[model samples]
Target: MISFDKFYSLFQKNLQNLYKNSKEIESIFFLLMTHIFKCDKTTILLKLSKKGKIHFIIYKKLIKKLWELKKNKPIQYVIGKAYFFDMEFIVNKNVFIPRQETEELVYWILQDNKNTKNSQIFDIGTGSGCISITLKKKKPKIGHIYAIDFSQKIIDIARKNAKLHNVKISFKKVNILNSDIPIQKKINNNSIIIIISNPPYIRISEKKLLHPNIIQYEPFQSLFVPDKDPLIFYKKISFWIKKKLTGIVYVYFEINQFIYLDIIKFLKKIGFFNIKIKKDFHGFFRMIRAVYYKKK
Candidate 1:
């Protein structure tokens, strides 16, 4: 017979060399191992006592997880899902996981768009389809929404998520790199009222400053652009706005805290008015909202 406390102590000790924060590492291992064993909170106590006697297959799977963590893969990727906007979505190497700050962007849209039954929204770089789907769900009255992405695998997951949640959306597979959305009029009879994006804004310089779990595990295409032109997406978005959005078309973006001032300035120069930058829970310059107003 094995002792629960003793085995846990050994495991924790072995992991200490891998993780500087011993308590968090221990917690991750405990919860993950228990789940791998199919033991809930009630059965976890005694299950540890029989660790060595556990099924070989489950042990092997958990050992694999530990090995991945030792090399710095995010636990969210390992688990194959992540929580966002108070909901769970399938996550993997193919697409970026939905983030909590992005949830705030969705909330802001929902709150501001109470009567969007007739308005049109275009979500550029619709990663995981979180923004587009949430908007459709929140304002079912909306005539239509266009969720654009350049990746097929991510668009596939987004379509699956939309189906799972029973929402209607048009997923467009097109690159927005340098396009000014030449077909804006064809897509909407009424003016496109809103444009939102949490584009790839992380520069190469900042990549070296991120957590190893994210730096190594998450896809660079989703998080970063070439450092030489970190604002590539923003520049294109502003061009689209200046040439396309008329009257009071609202624009929103999730930006790097360090570049908040720079983004706001560019928006102002491009005829964006009433621009605002919002901070996240960590008090970083995280979200920016702007309105495009063309001179009459």
Candidate 2:
């Protein structure tokens, strides 16, 4: 057994060579300790203040997790879960870990449709079902929610998350770029439809710019797009909305800040209007929302 303070010192020391920022290292340590201890950070700190001694078995587990972190594994994957919109989600290498910016996207959707009734939401490329599950949880009265992804493995992970959250989301294996939109023929004229996605927007060339942790641990299918057509997913989705969906539709996207202007232009060209861009906490334009009216 070792004193909590000493254990934390050892933990920080082992991570120092890999993580340069002291605060970041500390945050990682807290997440690991909380996961291992199955308690909140406040309780962990209280134990540390009282010189808590960690059992040898627990210490061994902590060391193993630390080693995983040192190998550039994402903390979320290392821990097997992530928190989004203040809810816990099951995550793994098969799915893209949820981002804080996406919470803003969810907030935007809920804000615009707070009083909406008989609405349907579709989450495209919904890895881990974070967006679709969250929207359903926040607005249980929404008529129906659907989420689709390319990989059955990814869809399975997303279904697990939906079950974990106890939210009903229709999960489907779909190659969004090639598969026919599954819900296209089910649209009800009087019902509002909201389509939202955080699709692959990072150009493959930008891979070098990302941290090894992200590039190494997250699924490439969820992250990278060909540089020749970084907007491919956006274009496909816009085309789907233009040709398939109808009547009082709203669309939201977690966008690449660098190409937001290009996205807005394309949406306008496809007849989506009332387009608005929202800046995330980092002050980058990371989300877009637009409205479309289709006459029957």
Candidate 3:
């Protein structure tokens, strides 16, 4: 058995080399304790004040999980779940963890559609189904929500997450990178079409700047684009929209912060107007919105 203080001391010492800030180490420690031991901060503190000791066997289990952390495995992957856009999602090595920045993108969409009703939505690269599921939860009146991903393993996780949220979404396994991939079904001509995507936009050359926790644990294919073609997914999605849809189509993307201007330029070149850019919490221009206007 070990007292909570002693256990915390040992944990901090073990992770000292990995994390430079004491507060970061402490925050991760509490997150691990709450997540792994199923003990919230108050419960753990109360127990520490009263019982003071944790079972040696449980201590070993905690150590085992922390060892993976030392190896740079993300806490969300290690625990098999992540919180995104105010909802909990099941995540694993097979799927990319839903990010807080993407939550900003979701907030923008929800805000824009606050007055909309019975709308149709298509979410491309719906990793863990976060965007579509959150939209359905917040705006239940929206018409059928459709999501697609390239990996069957990722789609499986996304399905489970949608089920967990008790939101109905049509999930499809399709590689949007394939130019020949057709839209699954034609949307109603009069229905409002809202497209959302957070495709892989990281340049391959920027891989060295990423933390090991991301590169080592998160799925690589979902994070990187060829250095020579960082705009490939954006271009493909833009071209597909032009080819497939008509009437008013609102498109949203959680983008690479550095390429916001390039996205605007590309959208203009492709005949998309009413372009808007949004900043993440860090003030990076991390999201873009545009509307395709055509009179029929």
Q: What is the C-alpha lDDT of each candidate?
A: 0.76, 0.88, 0.86
How do all models score by TM-score?
0.84, 0.97, 0.94
lDDT of 1 by residue, 98-177 (tens): 87789887888788777666676788998788888877776788657788888899889889888877999888887888
Please list the residue runs of candidate 2 whose C-alpha ends up more than 4 Å from where it truly belongs after superposition.
Answer: none
Those runs of model 1 whose alpha carbons end farther than 4 Å from true positions after fitting are 1-19, 22-54, 182-192, 294-296
Among all candidates shown, the one with the greatest TM-score:
2
What lDDT score goes with residue 151 in model 1? Answer: 87
Error of 2 at 111 (Å): 0.8
In Å, residue 31's CA in model 2 sits off its true spot by 1.2
Ranking by lDDT: 2, 3, 1
Off by over 4 Å in 3: 48-51, 179-186
For residue 128, model 3's alpha carbon misses the true position, in angstroms, by 0.9
Candidate 3 C-alpha lDDT tens digits along 1-296 = 88888888888898888888899888778778888678678987676567588788988889898898888788888788888876789999988989889998999988988878867788999989999999999889977888889989999999999899999999888888774345546656767989899999999888888877899889988999988888999899888888877789999998988777888998998899889898899999999999996664
Q: In order, how many clashes per candidate?
A: 1, 0, 0
Q: Sorted on TM-score, highest at the top, how do the candidates line up?
A: 2, 3, 1
lDDT score, residue 49, model 1?
56
Q: Is candidate 1 or candidate 3 better by lDDT?
A: 3
